[model samples]
Target chain A: MRRREALLHIGSWMVTGAAALSAGRARAARAAPLDQPSVRATIDNLFPDLPIDTSDAVAIEGPEITDDGAHVPVRLRLGTQRDTPHRIALVASANPHPLVATLDLGERFSGPLALRIKLARSQSVILLAATGQRLYAATTFLKIVASGCNPGQDETPPTDLGTIRFRHDPPREGMADARLLIRHPMRVEQRDASDIVSRPANHITMINVDIDGNPLLGMACGQSVAADPYLAFRLRTPQAGETLEIGWRDTQGRGGDARFPLGI
Target chain B: MSLDRRDALKAGAALALSSLLPACATPLRTPPTGRVVVVGAGWGGATTARYLRRWAPSVEVTVVEPARAFVSCPQSNLVLSGGRNLASLTLDYGRWAADNGIRLVRDTVRDIDPERRRVQLAGGGQLEYDRLVLSPGVDFDYAAVPGLEGEAAQARVPHAWKAGPQTAALRARLEAMPDGGVFVMTIPAAPYRCPPGPYERASLVATYLARHKPRAKLIVLDANPDIISKKGLFRAAWRELYPTLIEYRPSNAVLQVDTDRLTVRSEFEDLRADVLNVIPPQRAGDIARRAGALGEGERWARVNFIDYRAERVDGIHVIGDATLSTPAPKSGHVANQQGKVLAAALADHFAGRDPYRDPVLSNTCYSFVSNDEAFNVAAVYRVAEGGKGLRLADGSSGVSQARSSEEAALARAWATNIWSDMLG
Candidate 1:
């Protein structure tokens, strides 16, 4: 949908009183959807035809002021509504590439996900959750003490590339936590101090995990994802002796896979 | 002066009325009733002073420092590579002092009389304090290194550890050296000021040599048995980027330095250099010793980890590199965290509350592998069981997985935030 049409459709999808209140603020933010033209383009491209919901259903938790813009920890809590979102996207508005990551949470996963991302400067970090037909968005502001230097593009990857470490907590009250760490540089095009911009950005483009021969979760990462990217999420009813097959592929066409047994 | 309830209430009201009457011309002396005297205005002392005022608005804070401005030792190594200059690192305390209501005293402590709670100044002055905070950072043990006895000897081969004139001198020496010149630096053992500092210095110097004079060589003589902090990262950088330019020899302790020949002698090898950087083993600053804070023959001062009170002496507390050790590294970040801990403890004590039994401090030291890439070793320290001192919190610390330009940017951000936390 066009920006004007998205704004018009905002009134039709107001589900709760909280959603209506945000719809009012959405109209105010309508004066300028995003400060940067590239950022607006990114948002419009992500949701071309769907009307975005500015609702309390999506929650973003991050530091109000971050000392290190290179790695800022963030958590997103999707609402407890029975209708779980099919997809989630995170964006740092002013980054060289606004889109940080998009996760296809699969049909069964209702998440409280956590990750660390890179920010270029002080700006709004927006989280969007897509429920197939409808989209919900939340935003939080972060002030960078010192802005992150623009990252340099494809350098030689570390020698221990494709190394993966996976861990999971014991099931507690029908919920278990799992974290995955991948050894990838997540290289992106960056400008040097001498104003020299350097090659092809290389980052983990796809991540998929399967448990007990069933699809658990999948994520598509971007350059704004920090190096040695980490992803953590909760699992429901994780059973003993269950096998988890994890696979990921990078922009450079190199890939790695690992198998971790649950309840170890 | 025991009083009945009615009499005490009457006296309190009368005192309150008298205090209100004085507000017309003289502002009521309602400032916090306690006074804290802090010695040495480095990261530790300055942060303690600012935080004491922040936590307890009424408490008077006085800081005695010899230096006119603060020059950060954290990122000073970059000066050798021309990535940053001393001017950019040097900061004035005028604004920070004024805003925090911190009284700045330009003097050094000659001695401390703990019984009288008095601090004697070298400038023929004495300061009485209800509580004394000693954050006098590390003092190099020059006597340990034969032939490097006093100021005259240090002039020839600058330690450049404190990041001031000596740092500038070291940079100038590097600049003036001819091609194929050997730049050798010696690292003191573990428990020095900054664990990864020497390695970072070597890394940056090697970077400069590679860019300017590829034939020049940089030798690292580490006294420790192995690479200490960010070992894998530093080792990899030296191997990958500066394989030919840098030579790292661990377990090589310097025995002596001949300034005339610019040669350093360890037990195994004697190497001559066009420029020599000798970092001497360090102990608590002189004032810490004068205050009788350190135990017999102890290099560092022992303190009650709960509130950081000196163990051997009464009425004195030590923080930073002066304290008798913990798992926390002796870096600016730890000192700043210690300052906040001490300040909060004092605030609690004055408020008739007990200090926190298990205070936690987090430290992060970022070291540059080159001009554009860096890595960090971070830890969260909590009071160990039985409260002897601090230990690394279980699974609460780790080093960066790799070196990258992103980390270098974060390193700059870390320094900027920490410097601001201490003085801004």
Candidate 2:
């Protein structure tokens, strides 16, 4: 009779232990919300000294719902008047480091600039646009269902020097869209799903295009640039057969140059 | 004091009994015990075998490949341009074998015995296994291209499709051509390895010719009017960078080759070439036919999407370039994902647990227009319900816009990360 009583007592103890263990796990999971301030803190740390102000001049265009997060088309445009902002910088707050790209419009006019950015998880992406004096900011919440952070898909380290690809869109009269693609891993240091730390940060720091020795565009960049950075900006005076010289510099100070002649 | 002492003893006893109850209830399912024989060690085969060893530790994995080492086809274009060496691209199976406990059988598989679950090696040895994975890469359909027969073409006109010594041979031939000699390369129709590969090769070879042999030229005889993948990008690079040295002739197909006369006859005209690279149409590896693993058309192996097991045969799974997976290109990235899926299914089967339902697969292909320029197309796929086949998920997969610098950079990063994920 005593042994039977002891068995019943032990059974009750086991049930209590299991319940406590599950409760602890639930509490731990609830403690770290996905929308924690850590993401915002990361953005603040990426650009500490830049003179940034919030404005409605910058517009971030992306799919309302992305089917695949691996490659999402993200376009950032800065609105300006003769007396408005001269530069625009785009930041993806949900990304590991949050800063995707920063573009400076140096006395250029008309049209919008677009590029792709990678998101770490689905969250509100903060776009901070800075004028010559003040900075304007906007936030858009993007629902990312999938992540490209799985390193299993990405095995090779991109070469230090970026790949340069030039594509000629069927030229129409005097203007043609020149697409220059550079190969860089652009890995933002972040822990992946497998708990593996990503490689050190590598991104194209600057890109310059010269049409027959005349500077068309030059700009600085950050890690928010997606892998194999594609820079597609139009050239105003692209002739049927003029040489377009392109050069790029990476964060490591390595540089590469390629020249392609314009063809109609 | 007496009640507290009794309660402490009861708690200790309960903790020990609960730990014992799980062992008795679950009965550590003996991991499925069997040898998994994998034929071929290319991207698909290698990744499948690697993942099998990782996910299903109880299964013995053996890889049978003829080559001593593997050179990645994804990066071979850089080698032709002299950007990277063959060694940099080469990988030994030792690390994969020792670290992962995979058995590397360095021999050619002469025949596969599906009924006996055994494989006969070239040297009269046989390996018995419960499951077989055949990812034999790609085989050239020589009959597709007339007059390009054996012996002479293999000796003089190199295909350089296999990516090792043949790659070196083609590079040498290009380097040795006379200052004004023409280097003719024929691009196959669709469904070839690496759609952007031929164009990238042309771009790099042109880059070499521009610097080394100024008078030399590259003539591309393409089967299609426009090159696949990044044709627009390549055309821009070609016209802008090496306009004088490169000429593209689209909608031209090679009908015959005259080795003795050193000439190629197209449907339109007969052209003489100092060197020739006839990239013939490709199909699934030859072993799939002998093993009775091929589908109806003999082009690719038919496999069930949920588990990647052969649809026609039992106890066999085929992945990579050899398998006919809808919406997934015959890319290394896709193959690796398929490998993981197969591994997961096998692991569950061994544990006597129901495998996760409707496995999802993903892939991304990055193509370089030049050393510095790259683009990519990415997609995600899942098995259709009722076990019919695989389909691209409604909201997954896309190609980057025609020419965005940011998209191009992302494509390059995707390629690098893919390489690291696979081999690193």
Candidate 3:
């Protein structure tokens, strides 16, 4: 009878420990709330009057250890069980340029996303995903060893300048993943070979994504981006047999575009 | 791995034993007779000449070739990247020809008249032959890609597929590229000479750039979806040794070339190049095709494994890169083995006996991942019936498990042995 009583006591202590662990995790997730003044301000500037869940309903997936900072693969998944996910935004909290990307998905888009983003330093990347009724934010820590964004100066004018290439990965549901690499020196500064004076950014400044005449996302970046300007992202899957075109224009108005078929 | 000297001797013995007579044949044990004329004088032709001299001394042998001496394509990649010299690859045939009593004609065979049993030469000459052996190597299929048709264009955008002046020219171009420049080399579809040649060139060039021109990048654009040969070893070298210096893009077959702009346009992208080496698609050498040995509309000549005779043709045998020998790659080693096997068969044929009922062939391809490190893929083949050429013999083929300095030394020794077997 005494042994039975001891067994009951052990079971109760185990349940209590699990409860405390859950509460501790919940507090950590909520400690850096989206409602923080700076985060709230940025949020209000882009999207206003949105209540945040401050729960573990969003997860950031990526490598825990990275050797190259220029090309790190990152992805975000909605943790909520229900279906309707409208949009999501990612912030590289440590990057010189913090606004990584803002993805706008409709009812047609699905599947986990895969993308290559720049991380200036070792830090946590935060994500805020929006569903029908609530907002979710999650953070994942990453360690960077080799810096990528700025390998060298005057890396422009590659041996064969002005070459453009595109590749598309296998897509699932209504979401497609793609990559585009342009052989431009991405002359960010007023380097001599580029022949541009101060503040004349030859680096690609704007990238526009479209599918079958429908506009999707437009990105604006600065000189901190890497050379060769490799860009990869996920977007709404184009209509079957439709054409998906990714076009980019530099600050100097030198622009080009590449297109791929959606169906095959 | 290659067959050691002892294994080669064993194979020679088996080939000799195979000279026994077949059913429905007369029994006559004597040296071979009549005349045998071989064209091209490459690994295939040289081996055939040597073995014919040894196995059938009664037969008169003649080799008709345009080149002054034999220049090997096996180690030419090293020459391109400064790992070796062209002189090391150049070999003379004076000793071998004199010792074998084989007449060497420095003239190109233009056409073959099977009915008349004569060959027209480019130098306005003709040679009669009781049997003809053709080992003409591959010719580039230039129409597959655009902007490299004329001689001037070829000079500007060199293929360098054949080992000669073009190989040296490509090496010079690579040496002249800027310190931080990008060099792009595109690979043609498979079935080209030396399946690992392009990757070997890429690796050795990577080595050169890493030492002399730091920050330079090499981009290997492959028409196929992945590395065609010695894939694991090549990938390890790319990942560990040259993670930053090399960029491999496969399934990006070049569709057009802009020589003036120095651009390689593939199915999905346009790549700019400081130096462009365009290895184009390949087909059987032209003389074999024109002689109707490859049929009316065929890319490769079909052959019977019994004698390598072109289908539906008499007194003509096609070997080496010209024949569609499936499962076995178009390699010099395989061609050499074919030459030896055919030598024994011809000895029996002329001696009023039968050819070998079953034959086996082997090829070993060594690829240098760096100047001092290499890997190899060795395959053995069995001649199956119904004219399928040689089938890859199970359990006798595989790639090297790793790349190391040992394989590099073995590769050097292998090249020396094979060259001696053919030219010495």
lDDT sort, best first: 1, 3, 2
How accurate locally is residue B63 in candidate 2, as Cα lDDT from 0 to 100? 86
Docking class of 1: incorrect
Indicate the residue-level lDDT of A163 in model 3. 60
The digit string of per-residue lDDT tens for model 2 on B1-424 reads: 1233235335534532443332222211365486788898777777777666666677777889888777777767767677667887787654555555677888989988899999999978999988888888789888888777787665677888778888898889887889999888888765666667788788878877887789987888886435656556676778888888888865456767876666886633468888788888888888887788775556777777777778788888888877666446677777878877877877777677776778877666666555556555666788875455667789665654544455446554454454444443
In model 1, what is the error at residue A68, expressed in angstroms?
A: 29
Candidate 1 has what TM-score?
Answer: 0.58
Question: Model 3: which residue pairs collide?
Answer: A156-A185
Q: Which stretches of candidate 3 lie over 4 Å from their true place?
A: A1-264, B1-32
Cα shift from native, residue B133, model 3 (Å): 0.7
Model 2 per-residue lDDT tens digits across residues A179-247: 556767665554557846555455666766666776555555555566666655444555667787778
- lDDT of candidates 1 onward, in order: 0.77, 0.64, 0.71
Interface RMSD for candidates 1 onward, in order: 16.7, 11.6, 12.9
Compose the digit string of candidate 1's lDDT tens values, residues A1-264. Answer: 532243223312211111223223323333343433433444565565677788788889875444456667789998774767766778676665666777766544546887878887767788878776777878888665435535644367778788876776666787776677787877766555673554546778777788876777777677778777777777777777888888888877899999988875
Q: What DockQ does each listed candidate score?
A: 0.01, 0.01, 0.09
